[model samples]
Target: MANNFGRVVEVMVSNMLFSMDKYAIEGTIPFDNDLLPNESEIKLWNLSKDTISRIKRNETLMINAGYRGDVGVILHGFVSSVLTKREGVDAVTSIHVLDSQDLSKRKVKDITYAEGTLASYILKQMVGQLGLPIAQFELNQDYRYEEGYTASGEVTDIIGKVAKDCGTSAYINKGKVYIRNLRRGADDVFALSKGTGLIGSSEPFEEEKFKGYRIKSQLQYRITTASVVDLKCKDFEGRVHVRSGTHTFSRTGDFMTDVEAILP
Candidate 1:
């Protein structure tokens, strides 16, 4: 097991890099498959006047954070808002970002697909309209519209509809669109245990028909929505499908990834 001791963070805004090792930074980034864009709140402390002036709305923001050796990209999005204030003689800049902001809010032109058109093809077209790349587009079943289909309104909504028709779910992760089966997870599986950074015991919970556990571990970038994980704790031991999660880092000694997973 790699040492999860030293916290490392790097922030980039519009291609300008700011190392957290030099500047204190803290934030919470949440990821899920709720058919809505994921958002992040990043707080940077005591930056120079020129640095603060350069940050503007709609600029690209990418944050890479983890332990020294395990550091990876955790949040990639566009800045939606920037707020600065003075707290106890320190200047704090809070940057709020939205993943795939352009793609989520873009309204697709009304276009009717021909009869017998595959849902996957239409989904690709919608994503192409927003100019966002596809991370994964595997569907459990592809639906074919017999009477032709009309696509209108926001592209995110249309994608969600297409995913539902095809028996799956769609969501944006780190600026890429992913339409995947809920029952099956991604190919990469992370093993979590006491030696592998699993914190405490897994808490079991039942939500409607789903039975799963809420797990917390040292900040893991691999554990995202639709990712698979093999968890071994005193309370539970098995592989579960990650449904949703959050990767959080704070300078005041909090760095962890919390995820909700269900048995597959």
Candidate 2:
């Protein structure tokens, strides 16, 4: 009803923000650690001669996006690939990005903890060894790492093992690592209404497939994985934590956030 879909997508390269309004077609940035790699894709309608020369593989990129004047960073990574295609009168360019964790997957490391090592300490040490950027971190009570847990593996794998032992969920968002209890009703940000932000009917949860409601909302709220949000519809009413979410924008000034939230 209201004109609540305006957005701005900014792309930074070589420490400068390029003029993207003219090139941005549509882009998707997914914040997920389980199903898909935390990555982003920007489809460009037209690529200028100078812009083409400035972009190169392995360069660091920072993608910032905002909706209705509320702006926050959504992604950080390095350029993985770029391709171009011709469509009649217009040329299209596509850019792929890989998150920091993707960079860490290149090497293997050994993990050895003496008897009775704290889980939080182990996590901190592992992250430091991997040289990953952390924007936020949380851990509840202390849990000891028992003896004979020595191993050598990818850093992400070790972190997941530690989270399981501590009875917490570990995830990375916008380059930050989180190890905390599962989110529930008390963590819900606000209620959803039909015209306000909810897009369509809520899909019932199916445990067999690990599926939840498919929701499309305005980039009006700060939604991320493991954060609880409330949804009320004719067939459903409850709070669910986001399992995965994607924020996307197009040059035509359209902005949307899609989420798959699950009941805790």
Cα RMSD of all models vs. native, in order, equals 1.7, 3.2
Cα lDDT of model 2 by residue, 1-264, tens digit: 424556667788766574455455578888754412577887777777677667788788787776546666777777888888888988887888876546446345555678878888887777676575654456556678666356467777787787677766676665566666655323547566575567667777577736567777766436767767788776788877788778877766547778888776
Clashing pairs in 2: none
Worst 10 residues of 1 by lDDT: 100-109
**Please, what is the whole-model Cα lDDT of each candidate in the order they appear?**
0.86, 0.69
Name the 10 consecutive residues with the lowest summed lDDT in model 2: 179-188
Deviation of model 1 at 127, angstroms: 1.3
Q: Which pairs clash inside model 1?
A: none
Q: How many residue pairs collide in each prediction?
A: 0, 0
The residue-level lDDT of candidate 1 at 26 comes to: 89
Measured against the true structure, the TM-scores of the candidates, in listed sequence, are 0.94, 0.83
Give candidate 1 regions above 4 Å deviation. Answer: 1-4
